[model samples]
Target: MDVDLPYRLELISDLPGHDERAWQVAWNPTKPLLASCSADKSVRMYSYRPSDHGSKSLAFSHMGTIPTGHTKTVRSIAWAPSGKTLATGSFDSNVGIWEREDVSDSEDAGETAGDWECMTLLEGHETECKSVGYSSSGTLLASCSRDKTVWIWEVKPDADFECMGVLMEHSQDVKCVAWHPSEEILASASYDDTIKLYIDDPSEDWFCFSTLSGHKSTVWSLSWSPQGSYLASSSDDLTIRIWKRVEEHEWKSVLELRGHERSIYSISWGVGKGASENLGWLTTTGGDGKINVWEITEMQHTKDPLSATLIARISGAHDVNDVNSVSWCPRLEHPDLLATAGDDGSVKVWRVVPS
Candidate 1:
């Protein structure tokens, strides 16, 4: 495979001005909108359309900006499974869901020209919500906070906006939580230097089915493979580890990926990860000003790979700015695009220029 990348710098879009660094950006799966929330105490949406068939993503236009009711910084943002709603968690220890209500042509058409409003505000976590995400089915919203716990909330069958359950498991602040694409299990990484697994089983209490240990520092982020059988985690220890389950009784770490020179801050699994025919890749960004993609190959988990193949190295994307988070677009209709946020005050979009 041969391709030439100029390593060029291009500005895709200028988002709304933030009073401080933005923490996260999420792409809507069912529309052409991108949502970002930041220290400015606001969440805004920008509309983007390809100027031409093969044009690089530039020329994004601001559509609408919503001033959230929270007085603190927004920590994380997640688009609902249907893309009709968005979830945001804040440093104020509150999570809010925003839903789009289509304005009919006959019902005061000129009054408002937007498709979204805050539908609900959820309160349970006692400290700042560190992470929030929608499950694969979107019926559940999982949130973790500085209070050292994660809660799983189920939407009510009758009430359009209602919270149902709370999961109390981890003994340390849960840094991140990820839902498996096809299973009911959820994986979370914590500052306690351990990973916990939770499955929604009715007969038993919401407890850690297993605790994975190996990281030498705080765990920052976790992502599940597309098959929902494996988990990838990155840490301030400067390592990324892959974990895969064997049968239903046990799980094993298959490989440890290493390359970044600074503390690893964020990571994402490739959309096609965990397939028999494809080499599963994990992309990580850190304070070192480098983005490394690790190619994983497993003969079997029983015999872990001694190392991972470094498939791609990108620098200057965030550089000294310290990228706060990175997310691979959900494995849906488009799999080539990825979004990242940082102290640089921008969300950059990248596409894999196939080799």
Candidate 2:
């Protein structure tokens, strides 16, 4: 721990519910709820509120658990932009759409009280589904699989889905899929050490518009900056790469960040509590059991390279266990809050505080 660091990660609480390695954690964009999925084949939900003990702290309570009913591990979970629906992708080769049955106080300020039911089961991937995500407008959903393909589905009324495109562009297992923060464009990372960008063609189907090749090893995750001008990718090569949209259809790597000694599994970019609106914060963690928070400032001029500064870092964040996922809370009121999942089967909440 460097005492001189400008920021430090303050322990908030450990959410104890998942009984197996937790794969991912997601913050509800429109609610005070947090969700985690694990190898236990279950999804855990927790509700959080500002702590009475301190203004910078949050208190979390276990709300409920969804069995998910997946025959294998629930690999990934994503909340729809509306925060009313959750999509779960599993090693069972299926994607499940879930909704709460109890509408009472559905608009309440606390945790949603209801029985979560799988509204639809989407099956097309021939192998394990690795990741799932929803577009900015909640109109489109994307899923990637070990089948080396990405699937785009249209979110229809009545829990129905229509397959818009089946992208077979990746030569190896697709590890993760993410949509641009405010666009219909989708990006998929693969074990082939590349990231592919896709967009819908009005006259045809969704197609890959760009293939970003640079990482020497598997590309594990992708996150778009809050403003959508940049994309950050973590890789098995133990580095995070930043790509800039230099042209309408072209993107080039502008920066490479190296700190982790092992594979970087997950990276998340969020609007930070910085003084400038263009300053976005990126959090990343992985096999090294460490968490790194970097502050990225958008370039003032088009030709200037993006500036990145490591504002805080904590090693052994999971106590000798691999930190599988890290997510920034989406609520603007609590921009410094973060939630992380680990192989130790625990979800921990943290807050970035000035040292």
Tell me each candidate's RMSD, in Å, in order. 4.2, 1.4
lDDT per residue (tens digit) for residues 1-355 in model 2: 6677899999899987788999999998988899999999999999888779977677899888999999999999999998889999999999999988864545354465678899999999999999999999999999999999999999999999999999999999999999999889999999999999999999999999999999999999999998888999999999999999999889999999998999999999988887685558999999999999999977777765888888989999889999999999998898898999999999999999898
Tell me model 2's lDDT, rounded to 2 decimals. 0.93
Find the 10 residues in a row with the least total lDDT in model 1.
1-10
TM of each candidate vs. truth: 0.86, 0.97
User: Over 4 Å off in model 1, which ranges?
Assistant: 1-16, 53-59, 103-115, 157-164, 272-276, 298-302, 305-307, 331-333
Best by TM-score: 2
Minimum summed lDDT over a 10-residue window in model 2 is located at 103-112
Identify the candidate with maximal lDDT. 2
TM-score of 2: 0.97
Residue 7 displacement (Å), model 2: 0.2
